[model samples]
Target: MRSAAMRDEPRVTDAEARRIAFAAFVGTALEWYDYFLYGTAASIVFNRLYFVSGDPVVATLAAFASFAVGFVARPIGAVIFGHVGDRRGRRASLIITVTMIGVVTALIGLLPDFAAIGVAAPILLTLLRVFQGIAVGGEWGGAVTLAVEHAPPERRGRYAALPQVGSPIGTLLSSGAFALVSLLPADAFDSWGWRLPFLAAIPLLFVALYLRRRIEESPLFTELLQQQERSSSPVVEVLRRSFGRVLVGLSASLLGVGGFYLLTTFAISYGTETLHLPRSLMLGATLVAAVVEIAILLAFGRLAERWGPGNVCVVGGVASALVAFPVFWLIDTKNPALVVLAITAGVACLSVPYAVAGSLLTELFPPQLRYSGVSIAFNLGGVVSGFVPFAATAVLAASGKQSWSVALLLVGLSVLTALGGAIGERLRIEDDVSAA
Candidate 1:
C-alpha cells in the first residue's frame, strides 16, 4: 500500500502519521478528561466529601488546597518522566505515563468515603492526586511534541494544534459527565455517583495507547538518535542553556492556564456559592466557553500560522484584560442570559494564549531537551495557576471584593502572558530541522 515516494519518505507512512495524530489526540483527551474531572469534583463535591466543616469558605479553600497539590506534583513528575522520555523515546514515556494515569483515576473512583476512612481518606485522596499530576505532567509534552516533530513544517501549527484541540475535547467530555450527574439528587450523587465519571476513563486510555503505538519516533528525534547527539544531561543542558526560555514559557502559560483553572475550575464554586448561581447554569457556561474554546483554538492555529503565535496571543491577552472586569460583574448579576454571555467572553479571550501554549513550548528546545523544557513550563504553570483559586478565595475573603479582584487578577495575568509571548517572538527562532 506504500507509495513510490514514501519508500524514502520517513520512518512512518502517511497513513501512520494520521494514525499517530489521532492516537495523540485521544490519549491527551482521556488524560485531561480525568485530570480536569478531578478539578470539577474538587470545586463542587470535595468540600462535602472530604471536609465535614460547617463553614463553606473553609471547606472551599481546603478543596482548592487539595486541588493545588496535584499541580505541585506535576513538576516532579515532569522531571522524572522528562528524563525517561529524553533518554528513552516518546513512545516509551507515553506508555508509562498513560498507564499511571489510567490506574490512579480508576482507583480514585474506587476510593472509600471520608466517613469510612476517617482522617485517612482526604490524606489518601491528596496522595492519589499527586500521582495523577505526575502522570499528566510527563504525558503532555511528549504527546504534543511527538505529533509536532513528525509533521511537515507548513502544517506544524494545525498538527500541533491537533493535540491542543484535545484540551477542549477532554473538557467537553468531563464537564458533560458532571452536568449529567448533576441531574441526580444531591445526597445520592455526592455519596456514590460522582465516582462514575472518574471510573469512566479506563477504556479511553486503552484505545489511546493502541493508536499511539503505531507511531514511530519523530524523524527529527530519529535523526538525533541516529547521530547519537543527545545531551549528556538533558535536564542540566536545558536548565543551563534553555532556562530563560523555560521561565518565559512557564510565565506565559501561567496567566492563561492558571486563569483558566481559576475561572473554570474555581469559578464553578464561585458561581455556585459566591454568585449563588445554579450548578447547571455555571457548567452550561463552561460548556459554551469550551465550544468557543475549540473554535478559537482551531482558527487561531491558522491565524498563528499567518500572523505568528505572538500576535495572536497579544490580541487574546488584550481582550482578556479589557473585558475581564465587566465579564465578572455580569456573571454575578444572577441574570442567566447575561451570565452565559460573560462566561463565554471571558474564556474565549483567555484561550488565545492557552490555545498556542503546547506549540510555543514545543518549538522552544532541541529534540532531546524539548521534553524537559516543555514539561517544566507546563508543570510550573499549573503550580502557579493551581494556587490561583485558593489565593483568589483568600483574597476575596480578606478584601470582600470578589468581582473586581478576579477581573483585575485575570486581566493583569493576561497582560503578563502577552508580554512573555512578545519576548518569545523576539528572542527565539522556530526550531529548523538539522542535517541528518
Candidate 2:
C-alpha cells in the first residue's frame, strides 16, 4: 500500500496514453448519448408520451421535475460509485457506470407510454432516470481520471479535455437525433418516433462497452493499487480534506452547468414556450450551437495545454460574462441571423469553461480519492444548479415577466460563472499525487 505522501512515479507511454484517450472519448460519448437521449425525451416528449396527466404543462414540469430528481440522486450515486472506484478500480467502475446508463436508457425506450400502460409508464420512466443519474454520477470522475492520469504531466489539460468534450458531442447527437425524429407525422411522433432515439442507445452502449473492456486501467490507478493507496472511504476522505474545494467546485459549477442546463435542456421548452418558436427553428439553432461548441471546446483544450486548464477556463468565463447581454439581445429579437449568432455565442462561451473544467476539477485531488472527489464535486454541483431552468420557469410563472424576460433573467448567472472560473484559474492545483 502506498502512503498519502508516496513520490510520483511516471510510467505512461505515448501509445498507452493514446489508447486511454480514445477509450475516454468513446466511453464518455456513449455514456452521454444514453443520458442525453433521456434529457431530450424528458424535456420535449416524455411529458406528452409517458405521463398520464392530461395537463401537458403539468406533465412537462413533472417530467423535468423527474429530471431534477436524477440530479438530486447524483450525490448519493457519486458517493457509492466513488467508494467502488476508490476501493476497487477505475476500470471496473467505468464499465459498470457506463453500462448502467445504457441499460436504463434503453429500458425507457422499451417502456410503454401513458396510452399503453397508464401511470406505470411515467413511473417506469422516472425509475430509469434515477438509474441514469446514478450511472452518470460515477461517469465523469472515472473517464476524466482515466485520461488525465495517463497523460503527460505537462499535457494533463488537453488529455482530460478529451473526455469532457464528449458532452458537446453527446448534446449534438441527442439534439440532432430528436430533431430528426420530430419530422415524423405528429401522430407518428406521439406513437413511436420517440422510441427510436431511446432504443438507438443499445448499439451505442455496446460499442462503448467493447472499447472500454479492451483498454487497460489507468497507470496512476494501477500505481495506487500496487502501493495499496486506495481510499477506504473516498467520500469521507474528500469531506475531511477537500470540504472547501468541494464548496468552491459546487459554486463554480452552478453557473457553468446551470447555464448549460438552461441553454440546452431548458431551451427546448423555452423556445416553445417563451419565443413561440417552431421546433425546427429552435432545433436548427441548437444544432448550430453544437457545431460551434466543437470549435470553442477544441480551442480551449489547446489553450489549457498552454496556460493550464484553470487559466483557460478563466478566459472562457470572462468571455461568457461579457457575451451574456449580447446573447440575450439577439435571442429576444427573433432574427434568424441574430438567433443563430446568439445561440452560437452562448454555447461557445459555456463550452470553453466546461471543456477544461473536468480535468482541472479532477486534478485538484490525489489519485486515491480522485474518483470520489471529482464525482461528488460535480454531481453535487448539479443538485444545486441543475434545477435552474425549473426554478426560472417557476419564477416566470409568478412574475409574469415575459417581455425580454428569460434572456434578461439569466445574465447574472453568466457573470457568476465567469467569477468562479477566474478564481479557479488563479489556483492551479498541481496534478501530482496529492496527500492521501
lDDT of 2: 0.76
Estimate the TM-score for candidate 1. 0.94
Question: On residues 1-436, what C-alpha lDDT tens digit does candidate 1 reach at each position?
Answer: 1112212334545465566777788888888898988889888888888865789999889988999999999998888888887888888898888888988999889888688888788898989999999998898888887877676655667667778778888889999999999999988898888989999878877876776676677776666677686666878877888888888888778766787886798778888988778999999888988899888887887677777666667787888888888888888788999888988888888888877776677767767688888898778878888898888888778778567887777877888888878776655443332212
Clashing pairs in 1: none
lDDT for each residue of candidate 2 in 232-313, tens digit (9 for 90 to 100): 7888989998887776566566655777777777777766767777877777787898787777776787688787776666
- TM-score, candidate number 2: 0.93
Clashing pairs in 2: 1-227, 1-228, 2-227, 4-436
Off by over 4 Å in 1: 1-18, 429-436
